[model samples]
Target: MTVNSISFPHPVLGNGDDISDGSISPEISFQISDESIRVDVTSLQTGHPDFDRMIEAGEAVWHLRVQCPRTYMREDFFESGSNKTFHLEGVDFEGLVTIEVSLVTTTTLATYRPQGLHEDYGEEKFRLGRGEVVGIGPRYQFLIDKIYDPLKAPVSSIIRIEEGEDSEGPFTVALDTDLIMIHLSKSDYKEYAGITDRVPTVIHSALVLPVLADAIRQIEDYAESTLWAARLKYLLDIRDIDTEKPLQAAQEILFSPIARTFREVNMRLDKGDD
Candidate 1:
């Protein structure tokens, strides 16, 4: 199977029939050859604020669905009558895909009822709503991520460490226990910071802090039983106390600065009290 060519529609002009007069038409085409598949999307329309407001205030949503070729079933792949699939020999199967295009237009209407004098036309609308705008950014990011890393594995799986310039084939090396320990230590600190930043201070102190404290106690017990005194000592030296204690100390350090800033702001506001 092969696609020969693709085309798109031209801009459409309206003579006061609808609000979308003189707006660009949305069109897209795809050409599939033996080597690659090429897609051409033209005149993709974007909506304005009014179109957004209308969508938000309306009940219906626009949906587009593309059907797959029937030959996809005979390509030694699974098939579903209700769903679409694409398969290529010696390549991974592609699933059903749909592309949506929207256009936005702004127009000024001439007032006929209010005499011949011209008045300021103030009509603002969004062809695409707020939700649509917010959704588009994430969708594009997802497409980029997929194109770059289709398998979607962790970074370690794809990266290769080499000795010198001429090294080629994948080389395996013994894991450095010390490096692993350091990485884990840094990861724990980042996780602690993130949780402290997001959780409410009151709840963190009353609930989360105690839970973390208990977990640290368990870790201390494990360290003692396993006779890993050196590792335990290294962990303790990093923070004069155990994990939870150091986390609490770091939180205190962060909180004090915030408190001081708040106090200064309040003092200034009090001096200008009204």
Candidate 2:
């Protein structure tokens, strides 16, 4: 039996003996916040009795795949579910995110992807019968350059930070608000994921400090010198960090000069110390 027709992903063929072309259009919902993203899949009707009963009765389980900028995370399956939600916690993902929600017979969760369902990769692939792909809300990117996509750029660089091997949840980065956010480069992501020689490599912040300074210099040249009459204030969202170190560093770098200059001008005005 030649199986044909598929609404999304693509049209394909299955086994000759199987002959059963089952499709489940489960309801997928999503909500995003500063901390984590929550996804719930309901309306679990697949026209298969055992499958339907298993889902409604909480026998069917689920796992989640959350795709991020430069990387992706594969999470464990929900313990049991009828209309349960799987939370992608401690996840620092912005922009368009694709999540594959799967319902499986066994407790083990399989890593699902669109290409895996292809005929060539079938046997070793994570079958699609148990899963559906849903996208997050529209992703807005603040490209640094006035025009041109970063993915199309000849070269690209990025700084990434995340929790260690034993941790869970999104990795938080404190920014000064003035810095522009570049969207994730899909080209770099693909290479990085492939573990190829030309793939993106994780580098230390210090390594990119020069590139950052140079970029800033270009902006300063374009905008001319930025002068402010009032004191410069830094608003930081204090998370899990040693505040004293950063505070001290800032004081030494900027405040020290201001303090010294103010004292010199004040002494000159007084003429003599009382």
- Using lDDT as the measure, which candidate wins? 2
Clashes of 2: 3
Model 1's lDDT to the true fold? 0.30
Worst 10 residues of 2 by lDDT: 227-236
Tens-digit lDDT track for model 2 on 13-46? 1222121333444566766565766677675444
Residue 137, candidate 1: alpha-carbon lDDT: 8
Please report, in order, the local distance difference test score of every candidate based on alpha carbons.
0.30, 0.36
lDDT of 2 at 213: 32
Clashes of 1: 15
TM-scores across all candidates?
0.18, 0.31
* Candidate 1 C-alpha error for residue 22, in Å: 3.8
List ranges where model 1 is wrong by over 4 Å.
1-20, 46-100, 103-274
Error of 1 at 161 (Å): 63
Best by TM-score: 2
